[model samples]
Target: MASELPLPLLALLFLVILPPLCSSWRPADDDDASVSRSVFPMDGDVAWVVQVSDLHISAYSPERSADLELLGTALRAIRPHLLLVTGDITDAKNQQRTTSRQDEYEWVTYKKTIDAIVGRGGIDKSRIFDIRGNHDMYGVPYRGGKLDFFSTFSVNSQLKRLSTITSILLQGDRSYQFLGIDDTMSVGIRFPANLFGHPTDKRIEAVNSELQYLTNHSNAPVTKVVFGHFPMSFTASSEKGQRYESVFTRQSISAYLCGHLHAKVSKQLWRYHEMRTTEGHKSSFWEWELGDWKDSRLMRILAIDGGAVSFIDHTLNQALQTSILITYPTDSRSMNMLESEKWSMRNDINVLVFSHQVIRSVSARVFDSYSGFKVVEEIPLQLVFSSSADRPLFHAKWNAENYRSPSPTRYWLQVFVLDSHGVKISSEQRPFSVEGKMAIPTRSWLSYLVFEVQWEDMYRVLMWSNMAFTILLLFTPKILYHFVSRSSSYQRWVMSVLTSPIQQRKSYLWLVWFLMEGTRSKPFWSCLVIYVLWLIEMPWFWGRATSEDGEIAQMYLSGWSMPFHDGGLTGNKLSNPDVLVITLPFLYLVVIPVIVLIYGLFAEKAIVCSRRSRRVEYSAGSANTLAESARLLPDAPRALLMKFSGKMVSMVIQFWGSWTRRALLLACSITAAIHLKLCSKLMSAYGMVPVALSPPLTWMPLLLLGAAAYCTKLHGD
Candidate 1:
């Protein structure tokens, strides 16, 4: 097999298998690439900006509870110098083309949320800046909302078409030159942004003119930063692109910060050709994009120390503290105190742990600011007291004596434990810093892995067995059928119940197979019982052009909701599949054929009685006999009603017995069940969902199988 090889096949294998194996891949994490600025008091960094974007605040949106509280909490916790909101201020819910007026509810909710967050005084009105997003425009209905977002926030003074907010404080020593740019077209929302954008030549000229003025005046040493609502890449056409680099690169602008993509931390250098530049093209400008606050629940503290700019990533998920509290050394107090005191290395640090799990192991690791962060310490934390009386108080006193780094340091604790579910969980790693001469603390890493899995756990075993049992139950009827066919008594019972040819020419219709005397089940009691069950489901049947609802099956059905709708019979109703099983046996096996049989039986009896006790029979078939003998009955009124009822039933069976019609019913049921199954994207690992069929299609297989057997049972096919 190996000797006979095709060259094309061998080449195809090479083409398919080598690229991913050879290429380097990096695992994505939440914080590794994040960028933030810090206001370190020790380093004399006086100011930092916190950016939040895309607050799609709907007026009638459901409360997110704890998530809603994160914005204010994270902001207050961060204690940044200012907050910058780039775009997307409102949610513009249900906007329409005819709706000219903006929804005021969104603004009201936005104001309330912002006020609640910034009103507590750590942050205030003056420290916040905002710009209008496409949602703020009310010109085009769903695509746009209102143009008063900036005015509402009261940051209009900072709106410089090509001007700058000068002399803004930065690292206590350096002045910050903050420039603002508007790069949005409201009426079309992001439509124009996808192609050629609003013209940028005038803005570029104005910006360059100001830069010349500053250079001519020999203005104080400053750091130039620009903020905008959109990115250059958003506009694909060159003729309409914002040629920021042409002006910014000429003026030597360091960074361009924008927030429209709601992107996570990614650092990319944009290289572009400068118009009429003596220095040609260079990719020196750095673009920093921020994530959204409303959906992402993200905020950052940007700290710039001399030439080193660091971004600290923060998110709502990272802050979820479920009883895993470091009580003694509070997040705010402990780290700040350590940095303020400027401790190099100390072993006197203590931490308490009482996570919602049984402690399997606990330890602490320290990061050194000196020795390139290699000088480290690890200490096996001892459980001081663990009794049923109190929540097990485990303590870790990291011995930092081994770490002789001559700089400030940071430390974090790692606790591995088994939760009530016997699953291992690791506590969130918190970086506690001690600012010093040489502290190079890396970001804390927090995660855990389960070392073993118990295969025979009760929940796991019970769930698997349940799935096995359900699969077994589906085959039970067939299994019983095979065994019952072997028993003589069972065979006799079946023979007695099964319909037989009583008349000379028996109805060859497969529809009459599950009845007695070619009409109904043997022993009138069985026929009456089965017929009533069928009648119970009769009102659900529909004779409509639109196939949305029906007696047994609906054209359009979803989930566990619809199959049959007969509110009169049952307070709620039976599902289409349930109704199908209940009504089908009676429809073909007993109901329709039985009605025709009884009509003939009574008509023959009436004809004979009317003819002076002489027997009369028609050779044409029962259809003509039914019409002829209907008049000979003694009770004329009762006979008329029965004739009408039988006629109605015959008309239904005419369509009902056709394979095409019933197959369609079965098709609808199967389609609905399949749609429900395919619609679910995930099978949750925690809970087991049985492979049970849903409405409209659940019993399609059984019904169709019976119909198939019925149709092919005769040799005529």
Candidate 2:
């Protein structure tokens, strides 16, 4: 059967297709320059660079139209000498089936977008370069039937295809050169495979080959630049592989630029960036992990004038800007100081000094503040160098004059190096001491005691309780099943007890009515008097006194001597104890009292049911003797015995469940406690003690209370 498409669906598709076509046909403007501007000076020979990545573009849609307009406007305004579209220009293509109409449309739209970009006259088409990002190679094949999709769009011969592994050389007349490499995304490699199909070793070889080829072919000194879509090093992959360093070493590349990581630029980006740059060649290397255009939408502009490169970063929304300048030093040197040099007391302390021209030809001063007094007197120092160029690596030796005997306390050595440029780089304070006296102990015993107490009292209790509770909750049903299977009589008893109230409802109602009459006969004032008397007598048999205060006092006193005099039993009386003793006894006593009260209220109802049954049995006139009545009465006892058995079985199952629950709960509580205790200890050891109050210990108590309440509710139901 053939299905016909709905007209409304077709209309909807038509509406979606109309806007893009209209946008594409709209006349192109060559002079629009309102969007972005170059920061480089007008007369200077500048290198205008544009970076684009993660395009994810498909066909000419409304989204693509807006993007194209912005990009076109920027190109006209900046009039960049070169543009680099780093990677991920399109989504992955489906390779298993024949190319579909959608794929063809997407490919055409992609070509159109590129054409529009290149068509802008401000950017030199020859200088435009594209690097294969992960998405560019989609639909390519791998080992074991896996498809490498990024390679599909990346290798198209119709467009000016660029290699995934490549470099460019910038020189006069021959302003730009492009080197292309393969895609790193392929099979039989490690998890974080190379962007190019080749392994890192092979890639390095290729890069070296390309660099050597360019160096040999160029007529002038070429400014070398390399581009990729991933940063050489970052937090996530800092320890993963060696591709970053390997590629770096293979070529004397000026700057390595990449963009996979969307690192937040504000917090510690500068420090990490500075650390990654080569030490002596710091100005020669630069990296930029361009942020996403949709969210952060940041871009970088690199302007080169002769040997100087200036980088400016900007947000897509024009909300923020930052700039940095890079220049190679015309002359530089290295210096090393001998640590074995010793100071002498005979020479005036002022005679010791070191100097360097690059470090700015300024006098040096050294001071040793070992105690309250200055150990070394003021010293004047001079620098001697073989030549001006050699001054950068000059070193000086200093011997402290009139240096007295070592002080018994630790001291700090402060060195101040001042330059003619007014730049002062200070070394971290160095600590030294004269033959040592005992050092003052910074840790206190009280802190240790508190930590130990918390671990034992709070942490252990909570961990154990949690473990016990979890186990009990998991195995409760099985325990119940086992109890029920043990005795048929118990099962019968439970069924009878559950059904008894339903069978004798009418009798229960009459008995309740009789009790109301009896209560009504009593005077209200007399009844109140009797209640007061009962309350006055209840405490004598039910109440128990708590001694927690005495136990607490005892615990506090046992570890240290007290100012007040303490005597045998008096000391015990002053200590605190657990309050559970008094509370538990009172709770147990109240249970019996409640049971007695209930029995009294229901006694009349039971008697009425019995009399009714006896009358009916007599009317039947078969075996109506006392022996039969006795036999019938025994049935009640037998039923009760079966019910008792059922209850016993239930209690046994409940006990196991409850014990397991308590054990689990206790274990979890202990684990949590230990974690907290360790944290506190670590914090204290590092001198992070609170200046005010301490952490509250109420959580454990609250947890236990909640668990008890939950268990009580479950058991009662």
Highest lDDT model number: 1
Top candidate when judged by TM-score against the true structure: 1
Q: Judged by lDDT against the true structure, how good is candidate 2?
A: 0.35
For all candidates in order, the CA lDDT equals 0.39, 0.35
Q: lDDT tens string, model 1, 1-717?
A: 232223323433443353321012111111111112222222232235666666656554535222545666655544556677766676553432211223566666666666677764257655666655545542221112133444444343333211222223343455554555544431221111111122234445555665555455644455566666655543211123335656676675556666555534332212222234556634234455566655676655444323223334356655422223333222221122222332344444333333334556555545443345442666555655532222233456544454333333344433454445555555555444333233222322210010011111222243334323422322232234344545678645543433244453344322222222222212332233333332332231221111111122211110011232232111121121212222333233433333333323322222223222111222225446665666666677656766676566545534433443345345444544443342231111001122123222233234433443343332221
Relative to the unseen true structure, what is the C-alpha lDDT of residue 369 in candidate 2, on a scale of 0 to 100? 54
Model 2 residue 443 CA deviation (Å) reads 33
After superposition on all CA atoms, how large is the RMSD of candidate 1?
A: 23.2
Reference-based TM-score of each model: 0.37, 0.36
Q: Summing lDDT over every window of 10 consecutive residues in candidate 2, give the lowest-scoring window.
A: 329-338
Q: For residues 1-717, could you state the per-residue lDDT of candidate 2 as single tens digits?
A: 012123223433443353321112111111211111111122222344667655655543336423654565555555555677666555432332211112344545566666676675345455566655544443222311223223333323333342335455444533333333433333211111112222233454556666666668767544455666644432111112224443443344445455544433331121112223344333223444465443445566555434333344455553221122111110011000011132112221111111222344333333455445354533333443432221122223444223323442234344455666676654333332212111222334542332112221232244334323322322232234344435677445433443367656566444433333222212321222232222212221110011111111111100111122222112111101111122122222322222222222233233334434444554445323433545656777756655565466456545644554455446445545553553343222212232012222213223332333343233222
| C-alpha RMSD values across all candidates | 23.2, 30.1
